[model samples]
Target: MINVVIADDQTLVRAGFRSILDGEEDISVVAEAADGAEAVERAASERPDVVLMDIRMPGVDGLEATRRIAADPRLGDVRVVILTTFDLDEYVYSALRAGASGFLVKDTEPMELIHAVRVAARGDSLLAPAVTRRLIAEFVDRIKEPPPAPRLNSLTEREREVLAGVAAGLSNEELAERLVVSIATAKTHVSRVLTKLGARDRAQLVVIAYESGTVRPGWLS
Candidate 1:
């Protein structure tokens, strides 16, 4: 089972999430918190597999708490899924940079919510294809340059190519077709690129690739 913690400032939100998750056979709500500080404290103790977090909260807030949880090695690979009503790019940017494994609007369907949790638990990502494109367009509109190049020293040329393709929102299947390889092989390359770049997931890879100048904005369109 995927052990989870629900952290939000509103009791109703927490209760609602708890209700949605409790019905899933593959998941269990191990704990719940109403504020970021309490969420951090509980996270240290409970060490859940995933945290469903709200970005806006009283004290510390979800973003900072997520940073703390993500930075601490003692958390032992606990992943976070930013579950919030707001889909502000800043929140998404901070969350992805902080190593959150998933991002979803709170109004997301119950099934999607559950899937997001499962994806986080498995160390996969929930940055959908459409979200990826939207993220790129949003970033492009805000800045002339991508964030900043990630420190990539040892990556192979092939890995770099795969990284660029990913920045264009190419799914693994699409990547396979483009690279003339099997889907599994494409996934392997993508995973290796992520590991080399210290990216949390494909979304982070895309951001890093664009911002770092690994992939140019010219190619995005």
Candidate 2:
């Protein structure tokens, strides 16, 4: 089973999420925290596979908690998925930069929430096309023009292709099938792309791809 931790300040919200996730046979809500600091502590203690972290908690906010978790050497394998009220641009950018696996709206459908948990547990991201556009718009709205393209030439042509696929919202399994390679090989390519790009997560890669013009806006559809 995929171990999960639910971190939300609202008691009712936590209860709702627990009710939804607890029913999943492949996953379990191993712990719950009412604030960011508690969330961090619980995460350190439980070492869950995924953390459903809510933003705007008292004391340390979820963004800071996410940053702290990402920086932890012991919790490197734990995937953080930020749960917020809306797809606010700043929150999206900050969450991705803070090493979160995804930004999710709190009212997300039950099945989608379950799927997101599974995706994050596997060390990947989950972003709908609309949400990704909102994220890119944060940079676009601030700069008014594209930043100079990031130098990703350290990657071979194949690796770049793989990155493009990832930016297009293809999973590693889908990419392997498309590229006619083993799933393990596809995963390696993704790892190399993230490392060479100095990206902490795939959500950032998608942002870079669009913001850098390597992948056009809304290309994932």
Show pairs that collide, candidate 2. none
Give the per-residue lDDT digits (tens) of candidate 1, residues 63-155.
Answer: 988888888889846888887676655676677778676588889889888888887788666655466456555655566654645376568
Error of 2 at 57 (Å): 1.4
CA displacement after TM-score superposition, residue 200 of candidate 2 (Å): 3.1
TM-score for each predicted model, relative to the true structure: 0.86, 0.86
In candidate 1, where is summed lDDT lowest over 10 consecutive residues?
Answer: 141-150
Model 2 lDDT tens row, 119-161: 8898778855566655665554565466786577687989878
Q: What stretches of model 2 exceed 4 Å from their correct place?
A: 145-151, 177-184, 216-221
State the C-alpha lDDT per candidate. 0.79, 0.83
Q: Residue 30 in candidate 1 has what lDDT?
A: 93
Q: Residue 42 of candidate 1: its Cα lDDT?
A: 83
* lDDT accuracy of residue 196 in candidate 1: 79
